[model samples]
Structure formats: C-alpha cells, structure tokens
Target: MKGPCTPCTTPAALTRIGCLCAMSCALACVCAPLRAQTSTFNGAVALSSQLVDRGLAITPATPILQAAASWTSASGWSAGVSGALQTRDPGHLSEGLAQVSRAWSLSSAWQMQADLLYYDYPGNERARLFDRTEAGIDWIYRDVLTVGLSATSMTHGADHQPRGAADVDFHWPLAGHFSLALGAGVAQYLVSPYDSYGYVHRPPPGVYGYGHAGLFWSHGAWRIELDRIATDPAVTRHGGNLVAQPWVGTVSWSF
Candidate 1:
C-alpha cells in the first residue's frame, strides 16, 4: 500500500489504516478545550464498532477502545493527548495523538479555531512509517454547528502530496438529557504513483464521502452516543466493502 507523508521523507502509497486511526482522534481531541471558561481538565473513554475515517475502517473487524484527556484555558487555547487500542487478543497500541489549538471569537455567535497535531506510533519503524502532522481550521456557530477544513502533509516521509478535507455538522437538543447529531464529510486522495495492492482501480485522484446520525444522552457526568454510519464506495480491501449499516456505542465521564 501507500506510505506516509513527511516532507523530504519518502512517501508511501495509500495504506492509511494505521495512520488515520492513530492520529484523527488525537488531533480532534484538542478542540474540546475551546468550551472551557477557565483552566479545566477532563478525561473520557469510548468503544467503537469500527475505526472509521474518510469512509473506511482502518481496523480489521474488532472494536476500538479509546481514552483521552484535555486541558483548556479561558484565554482561547487548549491542548490534549489521546490513545486508542484495538481490543483483539494480543491487542497492540493503535494510535496516540498530541495536539494544540486556539480560538478567536468572531462575534457572539461565530468563532474560528485553528489547530496543529502530530501522530505517533510507538514501535513501528518501517522506512514508510514516518509520523504525520495535521493542521485545520473550523468555523463554529452558537457552539452547536461547525464547518471545518483541513490540510495535511507528510513532515519527514516520502512523497505523499498534501491532502484536503472539509466537513459540516450540527447538534441540537431534543429534550431533557437528550440530543440529536448529524455530520457529513469528505476527503480528497492524491493519485499514487506506486502500486496500491490492487486498489488503484479508482482512476487517479479519488475522493470519498461519509455521513452519520446519532442519538446522544447526558446524565450527571456521563455522556453516551449511538450512531448509524455510512460511507460511499466503502473500501475494496478487508471483507470487501462495508456492512449495510454500522453503529457504535460509547460512554464517557468528565472529571
């Protein structure tokens, strides 16, 4: 498959199962701090039926277990770290992330956030295993809707060209302790010059989309979510495309 993207570093093909799983949540965790009024820290745990990103499962069929911690300042800045482990027997570290972000109020109802994140793998050291760096920006509305765009380039790896992505999301309170959430996103893939384990059939420069709907519940410090997820073209690898519908259950607490 493909290698990672790091400038001046050798780039690989398009095998993202590992890199995407390890870094996406790690980087995304930094955004949690934007809501804190003063210095605050919190942690949570989660389980997912599949490790999904850009419309594909990075994991082989096993569930993914996740944990994260974040700290935020009243002054529009935050940082966080997270880790995920795939719970198959002899389970190994899936991914770890470290990220930081800052936000600026763009009026009483809109805000802009910028982020930088790094993806790390503990012991995997292939010439193609260079770590990844990601940067993104988000436009948030009334703290319930978000529009985001991002670009990432390999920091030290091979020749993976820069990638672009965008997404939109909305969450609304439906009743006491209940809420609804919807999201849609897409990613653009660069044409790979190297062989892609037979996945190169999608012409060159491919794009993928994903969508999801979820029900959320909050009681005391516990937060939970159940989501129905779908993707287009699914994937050609693994069990050959995805299931008709997949859902994930997650529970977390903030202390």
Candidate 2:
C-alpha cells in the first residue's frame, strides 16, 4: 500500500509539511468560532460509471464509489475531503483530496471563491506522479453559471513545473426538477521529457481540451446525472483509451 512520506526527514518534505501545518492551524483559528455557531455540514455518497479528471480518464468503464463531506461556515469559510475507490480494485483508493476555500460575494449576483487543494492517488503510478497542491479561483453568477481557473506546481512529476486549467460551466433550470448542465475546459502543461503522457518536446507542449453536456434531476437530497463526456483527439491518443469513455453517469444522495 502506498502512503504519504513519513518522518519528514528530508528538507523538501519537511518544508511541505510545515507549510501544510501552518495553513491548517490558520484556517482552524479563523473558522473555530463560526463552526460553533451557524456552520452547516453536508455529505454525499455516489456511484459513478467511471472516473475522469481534467480531460483524462482515470479509470476504464469500471464503476467507482465516491464519498465527500464538507463544512461551510456562515462567513464563507469551508473545508472538505473527498475520495473514490474503484470497485474492480476496492482494496485501494483511486483518488483522494483535501481542500479549503473562502468565498465572497462580489455583488448581489456574483460571488468569487479562492481555494487550496491537495490531491492524492494511491495505487496508480502515472497518476501519482501528478499528485500535488493546487490553487484555484472561481467566479460564480446567480448559482447558475461559473468560470474557474486553477494552477498547480507539480513537484512530484519529473517536470517540476507549473500547469494550469480554465473552465466554464452553465446550469440552466428547466420546467420541473431537471436541469441542463454544460461545461468545457482545457489544461496546459509543461511536459517533462520523461512524462507518462509521452510528449518529449523542448518548449513543453502538452495541451488538451475536454467538454461535457448532461442532464440532471434533483428531488430532495438525491440527484441523478448523465453526461456525455468527450476529450480532444490528442488526449485520447496520448492519455490512453482506458480512461476515455464517451459517457458517464452518476447517482448521488446528499445530506
């Protein structure tokens, strides 16, 4: 079983651990009061038809079980953790995350959020190489539309460079409890010569785009969604077909 580096003996690892601890303590101090009062806690469990991330498929067509829990304070401070495990190999985690975020209302109709995230992949070597800290900012409009940007400095990969992504999404309400969801995004990376995605360009040439269109239905705490997911031909050719299914479906219940 793969696990996080322990003992913090190395200088680099120790620095990373120190930074993480400092951030955690800071956020805890800020949110402690609000958490004692008007904070809300939410959780969800879902079954997904496949696992996908940033235009790349992380799993074949095999289904995965996912769970997430979050706490949001009335003052817009939030923290969350989420994880998924592929049913085909349920003994190990496929993906995991810990995140902290702050949101502000830009106006009556616009809101912005800034967040820090950590990603972990336990069993897949290629995926694990990209595991790192990510920072993101997002602008949301009227709970229906959002534009988001994120970047990461990937020290675990051979490149040890930064990568970024931008995405836009729209959720349009229909007559009843159903909605239309559409989104698209692109990722840019400085491809290492030894990168698993297989590009060996000197100027760092790895760019891919992805998009999804789907319908969502919600009633009470239960939600059902089906999306037709697609990636650019380049992603399919390089990222491997095993992680590139055409359609993904999910059913989730939240509380």
Candidate 3:
C-alpha cells in the first residue's frame, strides 16, 4: 500500500492560505457528544513539523497545516477527508486523502474495522504512478492495541502487481490523560524511474520497514503529540527520501 512518490511544490500561496483559514473556521464548531446509536460529526485542525504517512515523511524539513473532518453513522460506517498544505512560502498541498470504513464489535474486548483509503498528490506529475487505493482491515483489543494488514495493486504502472503491508500499534494510557504510543510497519514497493529531483532512483522492488514511538496528552478538545520516526536504512540507500525526517510534532484541536 506504499510507494516512492516525491512530494510536489506548486505556486499557490493565496490558495493555501485561504484553505487554512477556511478549515480553521470550520473546525471551530462546538464539540458534540458521541453516544451509541447516534450519528456524529467531527472536525480537527493541526500544525505539524512534518507530514508523515505510514511512517514515511511526505515533506522535507517543512512544517505543515492540516485539517480533517469525518462523519459517522449509527450503523458503524464512516467517511472522511483530510488535507495538508505547506506552511512556508509559495505554500502548496502536500497530500490529500479520502477514507471510508466500517467497524464492528466482536466481543467485549475485541473489535474489527475494514477500511478503504485513497491517496492523492496534487501538482506532482508522478502522482498517477503512486496514487492508488488501499484496502485493509484492523483488529483492535480493548481500544489499546491494533494489528492491521493491507494490500494494493499499482494499477497505473505497467506490471499491475499487488503490494502488501502489515503493521502493529500500541497505545497505553498512563495517568492524567497521558499516553504512550508505539508502532512498527513494513511496506512493499515497485521500483520507480528517476525524476528531475532524483527523488527516486531505480531500485529493486522489495519490502522496507518503518516505525515510531511517541507520547500523547489530551485535555478537553485539544491534544498534543511528539514522535520519533525511523525507517530502514536501505530506504535512503535505495534513493527513497523516507528517512530524512527523525522527529515530528503536532498540536491539534478536535470537536
């Protein structure tokens, strides 16, 4: 479900700024109660030091503004959209995502969810090569631990073969709204041709691993988190820039 795709930088300072303002206003809505059998809507806005997805860094040493909103029905189905834009000069989009999922409870201590996710990289010519749909399922234990597995086919490319991935994550609560988060995952990719920025050099198709350890604290509608991410050294040695970032921090408000 992962591939080597370079982030794009477009000239649209005004556009990006407008998006930031709009999202900020939208997310300022009052927090609503989320009760069983009741539909709910939620929105959040955040500032992060880097844009990382699936343990891969999407932006190089740049801060970003992100916003997301989701709606969930009483039937355990949900849909959401999220976007991130660079915070510096000539700000442009980093990435956008759309997701739909369904959840079910199997027992008092266990639950499962199936998800379909789509990734979009606007203004990047190679976007078509990496943008694709990922289908996966996750199993959760007591809302603390999760195990996920997914696969996707690189349909835009000539080969049209499937890539598979799996990940494990743990979120343990400490005290007073503080928690420790840990995750590790590996992804498969097809070698991509070189580009002007040399973002990706032709390499063999294979699997690479990435992981993160972080701490989180929440109060009311606000949450803050800090994480240190690391990827297989081979990711860089193979001309993939997913290893350039070491630390990521974020402050978010959700309602």
Candidate 4:
C-alpha cells in the first residue's frame, strides 16, 4: 500500500551526522542478535535521484538522502523505521516511517507477509492533512516470484478513505551475482473525492497501473540496483504516463 503526506518540522534537525550515528548503532545490533527466536538488525543509506510513490513524484529529479534500519525475528515478526531528507535547502519535504510486519511460512517454498506502514512528514505542511497509513499483504513463491495486495488509508488529520492495489513481481537470477526484477500493479481508489487526493494530483475514483524493471546485484550484505519505473494515468501536470523521473538507481548495504 502507498500514500503520501507532509507535516510540520521538528524543533531540532536530524542532519547527515545524526543519520550516520544511527547507522553505526544498527550495524552493532546486527552483530549481537537479540533473543525471541533470533533477531537481526540492518541499516542502509541510499542516494535516490528520483523519488516516486504509487505513481506520484513527490520530489524533483534530484538526489535525495535516505536511510533505514530494521530488525526481524526468526519467528517472522519485524519492525523498522526509516527517514529521508532533501539534499539542499528549500527542500520543502522530509519524512519518517515506522513499519511492523509478520510473516509465515506456508510450505517449503511459500511465504506470506502482513505489513502495516505509517508515514510522517516533517517540515512545513502548509496546514494540510497528508499523513497516510497502509496495511498490505504479500505472498512469495520459491523466493523468486511474489504477489502483493494492500490497502492504504489516511491518518494524522487526513482523509479517511482507503485506496488499494495488487501487484506481482518476478525475480530471476542471472549469471554471477546479478538478477532481474520485473513487476506491475494496478490500483483502485476505494473511496475518495473526485478532485485531488493526497499527493495524487489526479481525480478520485481512478484506476491505473504502474510498472518497474530493474537489475540487481548482491555480494555479502551489499546490494546494488538500477531501475526504470513508470505508471499509467499519470498525473496530468507531469505531462505523460511517467513522472519527471523515469530512471532510478540505488546502492545499499545490509549492515
């Protein structure tokens, strides 16, 4: 599930220095697993040149700083938080997210996951309610194919309708440590007004599809990916089926 929102800024700031400190802590946790059937923690930093969510371009086609930390239990329960900041002044938007998920192994090669995601924006909100909350599920087959469906609703002084989407993703291993990933999903607006939905500059009661293709490489705890992504019934202001950014690339480490 995907939705968008923005909120007022915090009195203090979390600069790059702060994020680095958090990442260091996360790495330490990764080495010292916790109890509860086995627990793991990991962190990563990413420089994303384009930020797109559910087919909407929340930021310009410039690099953005992102960081994340997550811990998972061997019993399939997990919790994590992540944050993103703009690279320059007048950035206007910054966000943090908290997530909780529980997964189950159905068989030797099948798994199911349920997730709840909350998004909070910090900075000037212009007195608009844009916070969003999403709950979704995913099914994975043989660790290579996945189907996901989810519903997203608003919170934190935002609209109270739900939007939903269903997506399937395929991952195929290539030579060496590289792999290919392809996916597409269609979304429906369950209950929303006709004009202007949170971050979706499009009319409500709309149904549209989104797609992505990417190449991935993995070595140890490090991963790198380059992708091209697009969505249909794109916001008219963007002038096409794709947002201002059609390309995105990322490099991250688990620890």
Off by over 4 Å in 2: 1-37, 190-194, 197-205, 241-243
Candidate 2 lDDT over residue span 1-255, tens digit each: 001111101111101111111111222222332335678666667777776665465556677777766677778777777777778888988777777777777787776777777778887554666577777777767656767777777756356566887777766889789977677777774233235545423323467677777787777767777777767775544444324577777777665
- Write candidate 1's Cα lDDT for 1-255 as tens digits: 111111110001101222222222222233344455568765656655554444444445566676666666777777767666667732566666676777777887877777676766453221124346677777777756777777767655466677877777666778889977677777764323123233344443356666667787777656666767666553333223232236655555544
For all the candidates, what are their Cα RMSDs to the real structure?
7.2, 9.3, 7.5, 7.8
Tens-place lDDT digits, model 4, residues 82-166:
7766687336556677777676767777666676777766662421233567787777676567677778776653456787777
Error of 2 at 115 (Å): 1.0
Cα deviation of 88, candidate 1, in Å: 2.0
Worst 10 residues of 1 by lDDT: 5-14
| Model 3: ten consecutive residues of lowest lDDT | 6-15
User: How close to the true structure is residue 40 of candidate 1, measured as C-alpha lDDT?
Assistant: 70
In order of lDDT, best first, we have 2, 3, 4, 1
Comparison by lDDT, 1 against 4, better one: 4
